[model samples]
Target: MGNSSSLHLQQEDVQAIQDETGFTPQQIERLYSRFSSLDKAGKSHLTREDFLRIPELAINPLGDRIVHAFFYESKNGEEDKVDFKDFVRVLAHFRPIKKNQEKNKLNTRMEKLHFAFRMYDIDGDDKISKEELLAVLTMMVGQNICPEQLLSIAERTIIEADTDRDNLISFEEFAKVLERTDVEQKMSIRFLS
Candidate 1:
């Protein structure tokens, strides 16, 4: 029947998204609509400036770093444009979903932590050095933070998260930070808001 064929096509489309993004139909549809709105002109892609206009992004403490990561660090070769696929891939980590959490507890937490780690890493070195954290905190507070104050803040953050005292925050250390109840709650509120 034609109806059955159309249903089959719909199912296939969902499956394709799942295969590509590791998200289900519901998440894909919900986030796809959200991403599509960022295009503004219905162009099916977002320029760097367009991506920054996302309301949540505009107000986020890590807005500049996040925008930089999504637009420049990912290096998908699109060059100043994030297509629908890029949006989905990046947000798949940041956007929390109950169903996904239920399926993989470790994965959900790791993904969230990984997003944070990537934001602070800045140099893709798989570790957050003092310079990286300083840069991030400096950006968050603007240039008003004096060099001494910024260094102290960065050192304190590293000391708290760097369990092994390796002078860097590894993913394990970063995950521990995410696991703290207060930090986790704040993260949920920040992103899910």
Candidate 2:
């Protein structure tokens, strides 16, 4: 009887996650299996080191920033860790927005842009300063471009994106700059059905 109740609870949890994240039961189960595999210490939460251990993320130019995004909401000196729910929520941001999805849904273009914006807004100031832009650019192309050329490119990008001339790129300015971009396509990830 206890085992049956436990199984029922697990089903409830999966259903809740499906409703919240727009992921099917199979996908959630598959992700749960992957997450469990990644939880090396069996702590039920993943630390920075655990995520960095993934070779693909380790090689990505924005790897650190992407990992940081998972822990961005931590406060009060809390240890940086991502549990199953948080993991699912963050991955949901990368799910392709369905044609029938509401504009207010989490996978919408605005949410995806917001996620990308946060990647560059390292300081959480709600604006991407020139220094922040340069830092991200350096991380992305530091090996390929000289420092001076990278600075020039960052400057040019800011000038073109800073519609208000405030010397910073606000979310509105960032969205405007990407107004014609296929963000829905570029930011999406294909999840197994």
Candidate 3:
């Protein structure tokens, strides 16, 4: 109620925010500090400068703008009360679905990804050539668990999986597909639903 940094935010607000936003504690601290500094009325107010200043906040995946807007509205009393629950709601709007960053990171199953890469090394060429192993991979497609890429899937999956352009699927590269725990979890949710 007072324009004081004395308003020490408890951990519940932070925990709830993190649960909703998937933001690390460090990020939350930085954000909280930024907002706390804007005690315009002993109330609170986020200015356009605040938005422009926090360069790390991105609107793309997390909808950072929405979170900022909510905070601004609550602090300025332009909206209703500024409860911790409200903060959670704001964070939820910016929450990152798991595996988003990792999807681009290195492979989870370095060995397996490598195996998938070399799995199509037909003609015992020791590497998957661009020629496309129709017979060998096609035969194993339905049989194997993940199965080989049967040319088309192989073309895309390989290209997507291959971080480097060495024209081979090393275990390091192949593990990326298997390491998507977040995606796998979501798939499980859909299955049960």
Q: Rate the local accuracy (lDDT) of all candidates.
A: 0.69, 0.83, 0.46
Q: What order do candidates take by lDDT, descending?
A: 2, 1, 3
Better of 1 and 3 by TM-score: 1
Off by over 4 Å in 3: 1-7, 44-88, 100-193
lDDT of 3 at 130: 51
Q: Write the per-residue lDDT of candidate 2 for residues 22-132, one digit (tens) a residue.
A: 887777877877888899898878999999998989999999999998887433244588888788888888887777764435677888999999999999999999999
lDDT of 3 by residue, 1-193 (tens): 3322234666676665556545555666655554565434445444444444444543322233333445443533555334433443343333333555432112223322332344355444555555544444554444453544456766776677667887665555545656764432322211101
| Residue 162 displacement (Å), model 1 | 3.6
Worst 10 residues of 1 by lDDT: 183-192
Q: TM-score of predicted model 1?
A: 0.69
Model 1 RMSD vs true structure: 4.9
TM-score of each model, paired residue for residue: 0.69, 0.89, 0.29
Best candidate (score: lDDT): 2
Clashes of each: 0, 0, 8
Specify the poorest-scoring 10-residue window by lDDT in model 2.
1-10
Better of 2 and 3 by lDDT: 2
